[model samples]
Target: MRRAIAGLLGAGLVVGALAGCAPAASDRPLVVVTTNILGDVVGELVGDQVEVMTLMRPDADPHSFEISAQEEARLRTADLLVSNGLGLEEGLQQHVDAAAAEGVPTVEAGDLITPLAYADGDAEGLDDPHLWTDPTRMVDVVAGLTDSLETALGDELDAGELAASSAAYTAELRALDAEMASAFAAIPEAQRALVTNHHVFGYLAARYDVAVIGAVVPSGTTLAAPSASDLDDLVSAIDRTGVRAIFADSSQPDRLAQVLADEAGVDVAVVDLFTESLSEPGEGAETYLQMMRTNTERIATGLSP
Candidate 1:
């Protein structure tokens, strides 16, 4: 009995040693993405081939969301770190930079597209990081992202499958762009002006040939507070432009937009749009494509004469 017990103990020790030697990051390649929107896009592109860890939660503001220490450690170890650059991920830039410094492959979606400048507001002349607002621009981003992912994860992932998936998604984005153009074209030209909670729709406006009169907050980031003069100026523009609605981000409180609507003294409707982040499941903007489609329909309906 003593000999048998010793043999079992030796076997147990070997099993424990083997368990300790197991890979910490699992068998699949890990991709750590900063924003939920980019996370969704990467998931769509990669499917189930790799593990994708998204930092931001649904409906969370990209400008102010944070991550825990565990997440930061995982980010540094990611095979690829994807982010929306041009200062969109304000709170997480330091973490992204640290991950890049550690030699993790990094891809910024904004860096992939043709960026548009803020035509007005506190962010005037600065590159607008909201590239996904225009599906055409997003196609450019998706193409670049495909190349980056192929280069970074090709050894672990099937390059042919990755290219096929990207091509399929790119075709869908082109269809969405066409759909948006048709919808917006139906609205009268005089009503083609947009007033949002902030400078969130510059890319969209530029894409669909609409004018962005102004924003209630007068800035690109929602973290910035609107000054009294900013609101006053936007209200005047709303009155002058005769815009039918004020588009506000659904994730953000619409109180400022409501106040601007009331101050404008017009029968302006406050339309809630998924401007920054995707919504929770069944919340009507769960996916990036769904968010854009819903916003397109709402914007077309709101502006139609």
Candidate 2:
């Protein structure tokens, strides 16, 4: 009986010691990412170095996707909060702000890159928040994000490994950029005009020298409804520009674009693009790289004039 009691006491002490050595809630560093694009980028960069808690899911609209109160609490507890600033996350701004108010280090990926403004429509001069449309800009975002992660994570992150991972990812972005450039080069200059559902492709048009003739909604965000005048103007522009294909965001209803296409009386092919969100597995775009590649291929095929 004495020997059994001694062994039990020893095991209890060992368990206590193990419990004492475990990391606390605050000590266990976490990264909360807002948009899935940035979430995926951060995941690729951090890679098990720290926990990445992504708030938004695949195929969800960033402009209008809201988080629950629990997610807001998680945001506040993060060691670092990474978001695509420039007001891209319009719906989740308050939650992100709540986290920042609690002293969480925030990295606005949009602010890190060279921000571009809307080239046309009512949103002109407003900073275009769709920087990820251009992979070169995403490369810049990736570099800035790496620095931000290192600064926020400090010694918790392995610098050498992070650098290597970042370099590899940046290389992939560059490669994708080159491939896109080569593909867009095939588009005859006359067929390089874009007329999408909204003003989401400014960076892409700017990057590839494609003309932004018009958008059905006449604004940057999908929430904006198109006025009759706006639709009329777009129809005129589509007819005038000889726009063979009109790209609609898959996440949004194609009803507006269809209306424009039918009213314009043009043989415009309304192609669907995963502009603001990623799709589920077995779908065309599941990752950031895959999304970009798929968009490029679809754009090429749709507007091959």
Candidate 3:
């Protein structure tokens, strides 16, 4: 009888372990996102049907963030990998490429949008990777993400349900685009100038009729520093144009912006916007939509009288 009891106890332990290892019935597809912005977009698209994990933390620089060994393991097992693809994730390119080589489905959201070339003489000849600056572009990304989700989730996702949800989200982004255009239209054409730390907002300014007066770094990528001549040229341009505020990326250091602001002697408010990645959950700029809205409101407030 003691031997029989021991066998029964062993069986019970095995059952408990198996039960613990089983995923919940409602657990959705696993999605690993390379950046917070893409994470937010995927979260909205997949909703309750997918488990989304963002690699980059809030306010982390996309060009500099490195993935850990544990993160690589997660990537290997994730159902999908979504990234803000216009070369923004420069540091993680190798890992993403490896995932693609291993047959993991990887979606590059920037490919859906018509990329805007960086203005001549900006950082490293790199294309502006901050595509979400334009809300319309975000609508396109949402559609691409929806397609990727449907492909990954297969019959697990209801086709009609996903389509309807994507349509609703796209409509919201369209409205945001209109609202920003109208608000920025109110800024005087002459004063509609931007002096940012880097050339991250070339598309933004171009879309809204604002002039990119000068950038402290004067490069498309934020990984480079400005030479003495670059700083001198920016200072001269700022003095000549009478540009007001100098916008800075939330993830970049503010020392350069501060120096420019001090030298320019203008009301250079150090506006920190989510240019590279979204903020953490509960922050104002946590989601892609919120990030754009927050940036629009800030830019309008700064540039407007």
Candidate with best lDDT: 1
> What is the lDDT ranking, best to worst?
1, 2, 3
Q: What would the TM-score be for candidate 2 when compared with the true structure? A: 0.91
lDDT of 2 by residue, 84-191 (tens): 988888999988887788799999988788799887778889999999999999999989989998999899999999999999999999999999999999999899
- Checking candidate 2 for backbone clashes, the offending pairs are none
lDDT tens readout by residue for model 3, 1-305: 99999999999999999999998664667889998878887777777777888899888888889989999988987788898888888899998999888988988987777788886564445567888788877888898889988998898787788898899899999998898899899998988988887778776777788888788888777787899898888889888888778889877888999988897776667787667777777767877788888888888888787
Q: Indicate whether candidate 2 or candidate 3 has the larger lDDT.
A: 2
lDDT of 1 at 115: 88
lDDT of each residue in 75-174, candidate 1, tens digit only = 9989999999999999999999988998999999888877889888889999999888999998998899899999998789999899999999999999
lDDT values for all models: 0.92, 0.90, 0.83
Order by TM-score, highest first: 1, 2, 3
Pairs in clash, predicted candidate 3:
123-219, 123-220
Q: Give candidate 3's error at residue 267 in angstroms.
A: 4.2
Residue 246's lDDT within candidate 2 is 92
> What are the candidates' C-alpha RMSDs?
2.6, 3.9, 2.6
Better candidate number, 1 or 3, judged by TM-score: 1
